[model samples]
Target: MRRILYAIAGTLSLITGLIGVVLPVLPTTPFLLLSAWCFARSNKRLHAWLINHKYFGPAINDWEKHKGIKASNKKRAYVLIVLSFSISIYVVPLTWVKVLLLFMCIALLWNMKRIKTL
Candidate 1:
């Protein structure tokens, strides 16, 4: 029962990670790490495959060892965050939601700055 739950969670995380690849507003690293953890608990084969994955594996390893994201990735993130927040703010009619989005943007920018650049 627990294993099934973990497998489901892992699958969901993997799907989110894949989406993050194209959607700059979504961060991929944390979701991929969560996927790795869930896979390890539920399925050994999947855990091994994820950690050994070519492109993602290295980024996972780098994050595990160095707690870092590439400078290029960070640059792109800055651009996307601004673009996304700007568009959303303009489209949303509610003042409270716009304020919340502004706060979220500030928090995200703070987090990105704090992360070590590789």
Candidate 2:
């Protein structure tokens, strides 16, 4: 059951990583890392596959080696961040929801700032 659970978690993490490609606040690297870890625990083949993936491999390697996000990635993330927050703030009707999204926007910015910009 432990292996099954790990596989499930790995799948979910990978899905989140995919979503993070379009969602600014949801970081791709962290989810990819979690997926890698879960795959390592559950499936050797999957782990190796992730380690060698074309688009994701570089980010994972950079993270492991230098512990930083790429500047190009950061620029993209900032643009997504702004658009996501702006759209949410515009469409959401509830004041509380707007405020929550505002906080989330700030937190995302803070997180990016805390990371080393490669």
Candidate 3:
């Protein structure tokens, strides 16, 4: 039952992470990491496949090995966060929504800054 739950959670996280690739408001790495975690506990093969994935694998492995992200990836993430959030902020009509989005962006940026760069 525990393994089944983990597998379900892992699959959901993977799907969310994939969606995050297209939707900037959603985050990719954290969900991917969560999926990996769930998979590691539930299914070794799924974990191994995720660890070997072309685009996300390196980031996951780097985080696992060094507890940090690559400098280049970090920089790219920063750019994406700023650009996407900026666009969203500009497009949104509600003042409160804009303020909320701004705060969220700041929080995300701060969190990224706290992470060690590899």
Give the candidate number with the greatest TM-score.
Answer: 3
Candidate 2 stretches with Cα past 4 Å from truth are: 1-4, 19-27
Superposed model 1: Cα runs more than 4 Å off = 1-4, 21-27
The residue-by-residue lDDT of candidate 2 on 43-67, one tens digit each, is: 9899889989999988777776788
lDDT of 1 by residue, 1-118 (tens): 9999999999999999989989866878789998988998999899888888987897776676788988887898788888999998889999999999999999989999999999
What TM-score, computed on C-alpha atoms, does each candidate reach?
0.77, 0.81, 0.95
* Model 3 stretches with alpha carbons more than 4 Å out: none
The superposed Cα distance between candidate 3 and the true structure at residue 65, in angstroms, equals: 1.5
| Residue lDDT tens for model 3, 1-25 | 9999999999999999999999878
| Model 2 lDDT, full chain set | 0.88
Instruction: Give the distance in Å from residue 99's predicted Cα in candidate 1 to where it truly belongs.
Output: 1.7
TM-score of 1: 0.77
Which structure is stronger by lDDT: 2 or 3? 3
For model 1, give the 10-residue run with minimal summed lDDT: 58-67
Cα displacement (angstroms), candidate 3, residue 60, comes to: 0.6
